[model samples]
Target chain A: MNMREYRLGVSHGLPVGMGYFSVSFGFGAMAVSQGLKVWEATLISLTNLTSAGQFAGLTVIVAGATILEMILTQLIINSRYALMSLALSQRMGQRIGVFPRILIAFFNTDEIFALAMARHEPLTVPYLLGLGTLPILGWTGGTLCGALAGSVLPVSIRNALGVMLYGMFIAIVVPPAKREREILAAVGLALVCSSLFAWLPVLQKVSAGISIVLCTLVSACICAAVFPVKEEAAV
Target chain B: MNILLYILAMALTTYLIRVLPLTIFRKPIRSRYLRSVLYYVPYTCLTAMTFPAILSSTTSLVSGAAALAVAVFLAYRGKSLIVVALSSSAAVLAAEAVMRLAGLL
Candidate 1:
């Protein structure tokens, strides 16, 4: 593995690390609010790298959910990683072995997946590992600090920071959405779908995890059919 | 112990989802429709997660809207994600403090 490739990966991961830090801070606060100790909150972030899955699973834990319930919730919430991994698998070099694949898969969060997939060159094992390292540290470290300081943070400040994650999401989508009419329409469709599921009585009964999956799948399929983007147009 | 088990289960389940596809699928997916769906997954999922929930994440609706507006503008202007996130959060903090002082929250 060339040092240059690994360094390149780290450089690319810097922004992702920063984003993960803030988002996991919010998760840490949420976990603390749900009655977990700081160490427990950090442990959750360490083991589960997903924001939505960790939040949803923690809610189930707070509710005294059954193990089966927890499993189902996590499976549904985290199923998107399967798609990301599948897409990334095609990008990896054919010679990559099992151990690196296993290690790379463990740290494959949404941001990492998006960043890796955007690359035009084939993804290498060392580069993938390098890319995964800082974001994992940032995620775990942020959770640790936030969990430890959860009580010290005032409620208003915590509430204010609440918008940071959503802001990051907007930052991610808006630039691309502005450049691509198809992406903009898909985003709008997904937004409308989620709002419907949230407000409609029967649909509202569905779990948040399931609602997200349903909305994403339905909107994605409809968007693909109505506005299939050309290869060059996709980024 | 039960809590530990829950964490372990979650980790295991999440890891399996990530690994299964990465290990098993060596070739690129061939289906056009499937490719399109996969292509749009990130945008759709991120959008779905962002909206509706974002409306209620802040201390007040006005604060949330204000933060979102700032975020979109900064993002459009090509500010980095970290800058956009922090600046919008700062905006919300300011809006929240003002609202609280004015008894609007």
Candidate 2:
């Protein structure tokens, strides 16, 4: 175990964990308001570690949907993770063994995946674990606090805090987009596609998860065809 | 409705979606097109999730747009994640405060 790599992973994870704390705080408050016990909300955060999927799952549970419905909802909402996982798997290569892969999979939330991918160096199991540790703690810990507190924070502060994760997303995308025309094109295409999904009457009916997946696929495919990364740079 | 069952099922479904690709696809992808798509996926996915969505994330469109503008500017200038994120949140608060002062919120 390289302590240096582990520490670097932990440092990279800190901001992500903080962002997760704020988002999951909202999730916890919403879960309690919807009648979940504090422990139950915290447990969901700990076990599932997904924002959209858990929120959608909660809706299914509250609606008294069948388990099959629950499964289907999760499958659609979290399907983007499949793509992210595939990309991350390639990024990690075979150095990450089965056991570590399984463990890392549990903490492969969107932010963690982005942070991991941003690293220029080859990934290691210890680093991945360190990257994951605080996020799990923050997510579950925030849920526990939020569920217990039950929306104690004022509306204005909550509203402001809500943008934290999106801000981080922008931070991650902008640097790379600025450096590469293909990436910029892909980001721009995704922006337009997602806007259509959000606003078009017919397309707005599509769920957020599916819409994101569709946007990603469309934008990525177009960019790939137009501007294939140089052979050596693809790695 | 069994809550434990619901949570377990939800967790399992999400876990499987995340875990399968990682464990199954250990080899490097040789296809250039596919690799390029993978290379571009993170940016596209993050951008898709950020926009339009961020515009509606805050208390009002004004505050949300303010946050987006602040985030983009800071990020374009090569700010760190924490700085960009906190600055964006601060922009939201500032925008909301202005709106409130103007009796618009």
Candidate 3:
């Protein structure tokens, strides 16, 4: 746990923290629009540490979905992180015992995962901690700032900011979709299915949590079957 | 009360998903099919979360759709995430301002 290495890791984390600040700002504003108070929204960000899971959970909550629905939605949406954690665990080496591993797991956002995996050597606890610190603060701080702004902003402006969440979603999906045929097909299918869930009478009655789970599973299954990625690229 | 419970359940669920694998899986899972499925999860989830809802999220469907178009285009052109978000939000705000002035909002 060298201090110099820890400092370097934290410095590398600064950009991810900056990016998270803007994205979570949108999340906070959207959460407020959905009726959560500033503190509640920030609390969710602090606890969840996930973008899609938090967003989906907020949707479920706003829709007045039940507790079972909330749990299931988060499980399905965030299960990908389990895979990431598995990949990371294999890389961080065995000196990392149970407690530090658990701590690192909590901090393993997508950006952190990428940065840690890119390292040529096995990761250390302090370095991982250093990487986690700023992003955590940035995420929660962004939520707090945005939620406060949401509460104070005029109605029209708050409504305008609501689109930012969707904008962030686009920023996440578009680059990959544009580059990969399989992803494009899967996303297109998901969009069509989601629209039906929203507009079709019988499907419209389906809970938001159920609809998201259904759409994600169905689309992912279809892509996994039809476009089974080649072995090397699957990783 | 219910929101608090929901957030707690969500945090618990998310934490377990992340920690279980880190604790349990010392070796990478070898199944290609399963890995591919995991790879597709974010794409499907984000896409499902984005659409139809985005259409209704803004002050008007027209403004929302216009902003979405701008977002997709900018992203396809390789814009960074923050840039794409800022530009798309700017597009929506600008479009809404026009719509409001025209008494169309």
Candidate 4:
């Protein structure tokens, strides 16, 4: 039974696992280039598949941002995972034991969520197990390989891989935004607001950490206010 | 102070972000506001992380970002993921060469 379930999990997670491998390859190489050891970079992928968090955290590490800064930055950047987990719990068909859930939570990333949601059936613990495990393993493994090849690949090649991260973000946002006018509006609103801060001198000084929180909250709030999702009375 | 301790500390702190919320919100999160918040948070975080470093990597800000933008456009227009990744990355490489030759960046 366990064997079959494990196989099932791997089947469901192949796309995510492979995608993470590519993405984290760049991340691993970058981390090493930025002076983290290969082991440290690989460990980052193992512990946190939260790409944005790691990228942001790398900045803090490079800049030697204070402990308080790291805490606050990570909290704001990663707050959405709390939401992802909430949605995931509702979808998880099997009840999760605390220890297992803790382990799974560590690797709950966008690729995994997209892969899991693409499935027809509601989630099972084994399925969630697949979603979490394979991708992270792929990520860690890719990072190791990338870190090893860091020097031979050259900086231009490395810099080019950085665009993969950007491509991923645009790929994530543009599709849904195209379909839903509201989502598109929220994105446009954020782009405008953020860009304004970009062009404006005073606002540019506002921390990126704070800017993300404010922009997301304000943009999302405005959208919600304009086009509220009606919750029918639960009879 | 040591590297192992540093890795462990950062790792623990990073884990705590995802951990604390699941612990508190053990049950289903049905809050509409919160769900809406979740939908947009990752993008904001991505932008925050990526924007600062992207421009300085090359001389011309527009070309590198534009190449990626074109790839994204093609992707949204229904190109395959591989197409998007390769073409966009190709765009960046191509653009840098052009910008350097043109001396516009």
Considering every candidate listed, which one attains the maximal TM-score?
3
Give per-residue CA lDDT, model 4, range A11-39, as digits (tens).
Answer: 87787778777777767767777788888
When just chain B is superposed on the true chain B, each candidate scores a TM-score of 0.83, 0.80, 0.93, 0.60
lDDT tens digits by residue: candidate 3, B1-105: 467898899999999998998988677768877888888998899899888888788778888898899999998888987888888888888888889899997
Better DockQ candidate (2, 3): 3
True contacts kept of 3: 0.82
Chain A vs native chain A, TM-score per candidate: 0.79, 0.69, 0.95, 0.85
Clashing pairs for model 3 are none
- Candidate closer to the true structure by lDDT (higher is better), 1 or 3: 3
Estimated TM-score per prediction?
Answer: 0.85, 0.76, 0.96, 0.84
> Tens digits of per-residue lDDT for model 2 on B33-94?
87788777777777887888888867799999999999999999999877887898899899
| lDDT measured at residue B59 in model 3 versus the true structure, 0 to 100 | 72
Best-performing candidate as measured by DockQ:
3
Residues A1-235, model 2: lDDT tens digits: 8999889889889887887787677677667766789889899999999876786677677667788878876775576688778879988886668888999999998789888999898999889999998999998998888777765666677677667767877888899889988889999999999999999999998766567667877898899999998985763
lDDT of 1 by residue, B40-97 (tens): 8778877877778777777688888888889989999988878887888888888888
Report the Cα lDDT for residue A194, model 3: 97
Best by lDDT: 3
C-alpha lDDT of all candidate models, in order: 0.80, 0.82, 0.87, 0.66
User: Every model's DockQ, to 2 decimals?
Assistant: 0.61, 0.58, 0.79, 0.42
Write the residue-wise lDDT of candidate 1 on A1-235 in tens digits: 7888899999898878877898778777757755888988899888888876786677567767677777876665576687778767767867788788988999898789888988888888878888988899999999888777776788776766666767777888899899989889999999999999888998988766567767878888998898776663332
Q: Alpha carbon lDDT of residue B92, candidate 4?
A: 71
Against the true structure, candidate 3 reaches a TM-score of 0.96
Instruction: Classify candidate 1 by CAPRI docking class.
Output: medium
Q: Write out the backbone clash pairs for model 4.
A: none
Off by over 4 Å in 1: A1-12, A55-80, A114-124, A229-235, B1-6
